[model samples]
Target chain A: MSAKIRLYVEHPLGAGQSVPLDRDQAHYLFGVMRQTVGAQLLLFNGEDGEWRAEVAEASKRSGVLICQEQTRPLVLPPDLWLLFAPIKKVRTDFIVEKAAEMGAARILPVQTEFTNSDRIRQDRLQAHAVEAAEQCGGTYVPEVADLQKLSRLLDHWPEERQLMFCDEAEVGSALALASETAAQAPWAIVIGPEGGFSEAERKRLHALPQSHVVSLGPRILRADTAAVAALTVWQQRYGDWG
Target chain B: MSAKIRLYVEHPLGAGQSVPLDRDQAHYLFGVMRQTVGAQLLLFNGEDGEWRAEVAEASKRSGVLICQEQTRPLVLPPDLWLLFAPIKKVRTDFIVEKAAEMGAARILPVQTEFTNSDRIRQDRLQAHAVEAAEQCGGTYVPEVADLQKLSRLLDHWPEERQLMFCDEAEVGSALALASETAAQAPWAIVIGPEGGFSEAERKRLHALPQSHVVSLGPRILRADTAAVAALTVWQQRYGDWG
Candidate 1:
């Protein structure tokens, strides 16, 4: 059987390359997973593709793995970004994990006017993205941007990327992606906070030329649910799901 | 502003009708939520539509609510069922909650050949469904069926209900719902366990005339993510999302 354990490392990965493991990684591979010398595993970095590596040296605090061969080439996801207001801790982690598994190229947490949580642990969220990528068998991991204000984000928004604004109040516009906007690359999906967007924020979003205001459905979905639904909808219509 | 709290109760709801809250409900409304006499809230039973209610009598252990008027008529979801193999505890609960929020008419836990968890707490999952419905502002709560063997479920499968079988192995057949089957009511989506379906199980599923084998995407998603993604896709094409 192929390697069941997939690890995300920061070192370069190629045939004949040796990777050194940190203390945490050593304990995880040796003590927790019960791996020894010559055990096979898959390794991947953001820049490199997946590689088949075997334990060359094993110890309690540190170890080394030598890459044997390239198992899979680097496969980048579609140029799609997910921007959502961070909710509770667990739900925020869920969103990041789901975003990585669903092939999001980037994840941005924006602080809105009614956002419940003002600050977010970007490092923690980034670690979640890495774990998700590892567990989901993804070759590339999405970058998690630090939390920023929604107004500033909109002001400095990339002009080329279209925004799929999920308007919870606009139940009538039922996600008619075929007619609303042409399915294309370089897209972002924006989900609001629990209390939803202020009237001014909605008006500003509506006035943006790059925004395609749409609704998930008739029901009032929670912010987390909205994120997943919006990602699924966007991926199906515009991304690489098809 | 309208009532911010939506609750699911077992009692009948109607104009001027008085309903008694159980101990847990009384504790939640009166003690936890700090709601007193004259406070208004929205209530829904499985059979009745959502009704606006006023607190007639309030105490720490008991309370009474008088219905004011129907706020939302019963908006039943399309005839869709979600069949999934139970994974970890938190993920299983996540599946039930998402099923309720995403418009599944029923949720079934099936024990497949590769299923790790053979038994599930039906009552706990059902409670989660109710909570999800209450939080999502859904007037209808879907039923959560007890765990059963996959073979038994297939033996008595409904002929009219088409099955959207999500085969993780078939990465080639992208989810082409439009071409595979005509979008209609009375459909079900089946997601396998983390280990995926056994070969025999896959063969049987493929042999079934009602099964439409499809893939979520190129990346392998966890069971919970697959459930949500499959529901979103099926709802967008076959259910009431349009």
Candidate 2:
């Protein structure tokens, strides 16, 4: 952890290997961040663990970094997915960023019957996830899946993965579903859009054999806040936070 | 629960009573949110429970609502406070807004050694708190205190109140502080600024008799995310969410 500046790179990292930086990475390191030849930093490639690398060559639009040693092993997030309908642009970004920071392994933007937006900019949202991981000192970045219809996703739902269906209408279930899941099982947390789930959608979710409708709490949370809050509680109850 | 719109008002609410709105409130209700005469909504005054109300009159700069009846009794939040060093403008607002939505009883902005912002707009932050409560259908609005010195606040800290000190440096304390606090005792979650706590400040917090240093998780989080995560975990472990 000698390198205070950590960057996520796509190249394979190993000792005595030279990693080439793309134009954007070169400009970010040399021009924007003021990194230079001989400067040290940490790099992670999602496959390899984090590595300590030193600038071997610096240029305006190209650079090279020589991996010195491994800094940290890759720490994968929990076997969890965040499934939600995209809301407003900014809040949707916030949900993805917070989900990345709060230990979600995958981010899924679901399209429900009442979901307002017809489509989402998948590339933009994925970039936000990457940026969140970079800023939050995370070694692993969650994949941001392209938007999918909730109905289709439910039709192909993995029976092995427990679904923590967060519903405001089921507020007083007496027993929180957080307690029922086995600690190591694959799981996903589903949150609706601002308009919430339609009657048919709610009924379909309630009838799922693997779905566990969990209440977030007594208070009504906006869709974005509910996503972060759900991740936090789940991490506290059974994720890596414990 | 029948009312679609929720607004926070300062006037007393009861059956057949009129509640007047200020210019901003009127503009929001009449112009932005488009509530016209005879339109029904929900109102809460912090002092009273939520009440169903109907628009009695609509105007350019002022309006009135007559309370129909009480819809919900006051549900007091757990005696929890969120204390954190103010960061950048948008994030500070986000922290206050989420704290209000996540069941924090009070919000305190404390000056610390590593705090970058010299001062905060208390009124603006408080407005954000109110907005969050209104949007989340919260019956109670947490008071946002003006910025105060951490040392002075600690000096006057109540003995009965327990502090959950979120420290990245103390990441391996397997037992979460949430389990240590009594269910109904006054509690506060302290999050450091973006630059994190100075060594001396961290030492002082660790030495405090009332403070229990706890780790958020293996991964590092931004200051705003940490505040929300802390509140969420607290609510899940011991607060009203249970």
Candidate 3:
């Protein structure tokens, strides 16, 4: 079996590097998980590759781990941003977790015209991303940005990045990601809210030169399902996982 | 806007067909949603197409709906079955919901050697599938089969149906669905449990003639994520999501 305990840390990792655990981490490792001194676990600090670490000190409120060897190199995901409208609390959490596991480079919650959720807890969602990365054995953890307005983001959209707009209205249309764009290019997938994009938002997205309005399928998939489906379609054709 | 309430009924749907609502359905439509007489809603019976129905008789204990016109013909999902080892309760419900939303014709919970869940509430999972169909505007709800042994399933595997085995061990291999198999063929996708497949099971699967071992990506995906990802990949290439 793979390493059962993989953690996302903040300290830089190298051979013989001693990393101090916070109160919460210490409690989790020593008290909750019953790990003693010299217990081995994997650690990744987002920038550094994964490392095999052994517990150097174990206490109730504090603990330390010393890096033994590098397990895997940092493998970054393709330059893909997932822009989605937040829904219910549990489903929004699901979106962030799945995005992190599915190899999104960055995740941005966009407030669209028909979006029901106007606010989101960025810290909690970011923690979910980190937890997802830890569970999926992913060395690279994607950044989860704070919620933002979709219209404003579109106004200052990057010229190099292609926007994949998942339009529920565009059913029966082909997913032309592979045919229209090259692989490994800067791309972002935008999924609408549960209420779907408004007429004006749809018009604006269709008029945008960088936007590629593609359909997931004939059926109207829920926003969460659409996010995963769009990511899968894009990854299968344009990103890694070929 | 689309129909505010979409219900799955067992009665035949056609013009002037009066369908009786069950006590549970009545409680949901009347008590919870507060629908009165003449409230218009959409209904589908899986075999028949969707129909516009009006509350012809509204009572505290029961109700009746009169079907007016055929709104949409029955659009059956692709003949794809999802066979997965059951996981935790919520995640198992998620897999069933996603399978119904993503257009799986049938869902089977298989017991693998590494599978922790030995028994599952099949009726509860079936209700989840119905709820998913109701929310996603899907006319057909996939049947959730009872838990069975994976080895027994493979023993009686249909010769004509191709098996898309999502093997986490085969990470770097290409998902050669398009090149290896023809579209619209009878197919099934099998996802392993959280602990993954045993060595004996993997050997047997690899030895199966109809098994197509494919990889989702480089990183290890959770059981729920893998189910959605595998469905999306298969649907895009060989199923109905083109």
The candidate scoring highest on TM-score is: 3
| Range of the 10 consecutive residues with the lowest summed lDDT in candidate 3 chain A | A176-185
Any residue pairs clashing in model 1, and if so which?
none
Each prediction's TM-score against the native? 0.97, 0.95, 0.97
**Chain A: TM-score in each candidate?**
0.95, 0.95, 0.96
lDDT measured at residue A89 in model 1 versus the true structure, 0 to 100: 91
**Each candidate: RMSD to true structure?**
1.8, 2.1, 1.6
- Tens-digit per-residue lDDT, B69-140, candidate 1: 999899999999999999999999998998898999999999999888878999999999999999888999
Docking quality band of candidate 2, CAPRI definitions: medium
Native contact fraction, candidates in order: 0.69, 0.73, 0.70
Off by over 4 Å in 1: A176-182, B177-182
Pairwise DockQ winner, candidates 1 and 2: 1
Question: What is the full ranking by DockQ, best candidate first?
Answer: 3, 1, 2
- Candidate topping DockQ: 3
**What is candidate 1's fraction of native contacts?**
0.69
Model 2 per-residue lDDT tens digits across residues B66-146: 999899998888999899999888888989999998999999999998887778999999999999988887899999999
Residue A197 C-alpha lDDT in model 2: 93
What is the lDDT of every predicted structure here? 0.89, 0.87, 0.89
- Candidate 1 chain A, which ten residues in sequence have the lowest lDDT sum? A176-185
lDDT of 2 by residue, A1-242 (tens): 23777888888889998999999999989999898889999888877888889999999999999999997888999989999999989899999999999889999999999988888999999889988888787889899999999999999999788888888898755334443444568989999888889999999999988777778788888887888877876777678876
